[model samples]
Target: MPLQAHVVAPSRTAHVLEIIKGAILSGDLAAGSPLVETDLALQLGVSKTPVREALKTLEGTGLVVIRPYLGATVREMSYEDAAAVYDMRLLLEPEAVRRTVAAGGRLSAAERALERAREADGGVARSAANREFHRALYEGCGNPLLVASLDGLRDQTSLVSVAAWARRASWETEAAEHEEILGAAREGRADEAADLVRRHVAAFLDRLPKQDIDPAPPSP
Candidate 1:
């Protein structure tokens, strides 16, 4: 059965994108699931124009894959792809967080995001909160270019994290790690916070299934 996403008009494409992005993160639209325009349009009570535009945007986010003639499907990350994403994060995020911590950056937002993630029962909610928490950690690094680079990776990171959650149901462990990272940052232990961030990233990567995902379906 096709997934149904409800949306209202007026900048409907952005609304549609968020709705479908939430579905994908929450596993309502599982990896490799097809996104048929007609079905989505009918289900959403809109014309195919908005759906098409939203899909094209999602494709750029690395959450949706589009083939020449195969239409669109939720993206599937190979083991190498996952590793590379994590590796880039390992090289970038920890250092950024360290700079933020060293600069005595504000961290009230990170604390709030941590609480939200702990309270969230859905993967989508947790994913959004998690993104916010990490953003708070690094956005204060005083380097806009570095922050921008990290922002570029945020969507891919969310997809990878959701996949990791599917393999291991205990996000509490990750939450605990976040607590440690934040604690160090708040205490002005910049190096410790940076190292903790590194460990946290590596730990999540280790938790991923030790194999590449199946190839994406040509037509879902």
Candidate 2:
């Protein structure tokens, strides 16, 4: 079955870009998978122009790569690329969490976060929900730039995490780690919470395949 792009407006190419980007981040579209315009246009019921525009937008963001004759594919993550994104997250998100926790008030969202982490489906959905939960924890940090940058980093890290999730045998443990971080945050232990997140992120990055591991390159 072909996937349809849900277009809400004709002028908002960014909206379409977001949907496709979400698809990529959530692991609905795997790395190295080709994006066919005609099929996407037909599926989305939108004109080819918007589809093209959305692809261009993603290409610019480095989420999708466009080639001359081969066309567009989701950008693949090498061990180095994956490690860099996660390492950045390890450096940045803890600060955001600490700042938010220090400025503490209500953490009603944390309850929902725990639930989502526990119940969301394995693999991509779990990772997506986990990312959202982390964002919710830091939404009160009061820095718009931090929030936006962390959001992008989270999306990039997710791409690598999803790929790892699909290939690894112990993928089920990610959800449990999410809950541990959320629990620390919910308790107002900003330092401990940040430490937990740092460790959680670092552990995954440590396991990433080296450049020489050679993923059985996806079929053409």
Candidate 3:
């Protein structure tokens, strides 16, 4: 009998990206932690090439930084960076919500995401669901550029360990606020939806604890 050759699946760059992203979002990889390709490749059960590519993709999303000589490391979300992200959200989200309501957009996806958030226990799952809820709300805004910008801000904020914050903070208020915003949008109350979104974001920023950036140690 002839020996059978095993078939290998093609490179899974997306899979690698997701694993690394999950690690970062789950707080397994802290901010400023060095991303050594060899270590990551071994940990992920893939080659260094895939890990390198994934890191580059993560860099584009502002989750990883590739310095000229220092290689890749998780990006730190300083207080200033977080404040700027919140400010941008405050400026853009209101209009996005208003536009979505004016267009009579369906809230099915947003509703599902909100439900997921409500059901999820605190941590990465809840944080992810919360992000999905916001994404779904603004996705029908009829402006791809605006949506993309908001997505980038959301990703950057995630890198700041929003899940960790969720674990520590009381999320009941956030859920209630989301329900009110969703109701306003579903009822086609454009101005009210917009105002509610603005207030929701502002309140979140107000509740965030002030903290200095503590950079992670480099990987050995």
Candidate 4:
């Protein structure tokens, strides 16, 4: 009998997606920077097929822009986009958290995320932890579709967050706000928790830069 294969690598597209997305989020790739498929494929030791697929996925996530003749580049952040993204979050996230709290969902993951955010040394890690904290608060709302909608906005929201951090160093304020939100949730004050989340999101929106933040110049 032939030996069975138990170990297999994840799909190339998924791997490439993580690499490209990581770079984008960490500012390694920068906003508006070109995502040249050939260069990426060569750098990543893969073919253009995976790079192309990954770019398409990033585009869907609002992290990449593909123009008719420009190919793919990292998406830029602007006040308008920030308003739209956070406006939707302000509408959906608080209510979802309210539902989750009313249902008495587990919050261990949320607490862990909060801790991670507090300990993070930089904007990227903190943003990721912040995302996880919010997700944990709302992911147990018993509505998959609602969760999906929130999930759809995550990448764009995170991108805007990093940009906001770059403009203003106010993570301390946000971290304190998160603590209050988590405290309310932990105390089973559903309505209060919801209100805190709304305030948190709205405050972040208010801090967004009004001008567009373009990506770094494209490689020569």
Model 1, span 1-220: residue lDDT tens: 4556577767789888887887887778888899999988888878899989999988987889999898999887777888888899999999999999999999999999999999998877898899999999999999999999899888888888777676666588999999999999889999999999999999888877665243444785
Q: Which regions of candidate 2 fall more than 4 Å away from where they truly are? A: 5-19, 22-28, 67-71, 169-171, 211-214, 217-220
Candidate 3 lDDT over 137-194, as tens digits, reads 8888999999999998877766544633643464678889999999888889999999
Which 10-residue window in model 3 sums to the lowest lDDT? 1-10
Q: Which residue pairs come into collision in candidate 3?
A: none
lDDT score of residue 143 within candidate 3: 99
The TM-score values for the models, in the order shown, are: 0.89, 0.82, 0.89, 0.91
Full-model lDDT, candidate 1: 0.87
lDDT of 3: 0.80
RMSD of each: 3.0, 3.2, 5.8, 6.0
- The per-prediction tally of clashing pairs is 0, 2, 0, 2
How displaced is residue 120 in candidate 2, in Å? 1.8
Q: Model 3 segments beyond 4 Å from truth?
A: 1-8, 161-167, 212-220
Overall lDDT per candidate, in order of appearance: 0.87, 0.75, 0.80, 0.87
Kindly list the per-residue Cα lDDT of model 2 for residues 63-157, writing each as its tens digit.
Answer: 89999999999898777777678777887888888888878845777667667767766666677677777788777788999988887776666
Choose the strongest candidate by TM-score.
4
- TM-score ranking of the models: 4, 1, 3, 2
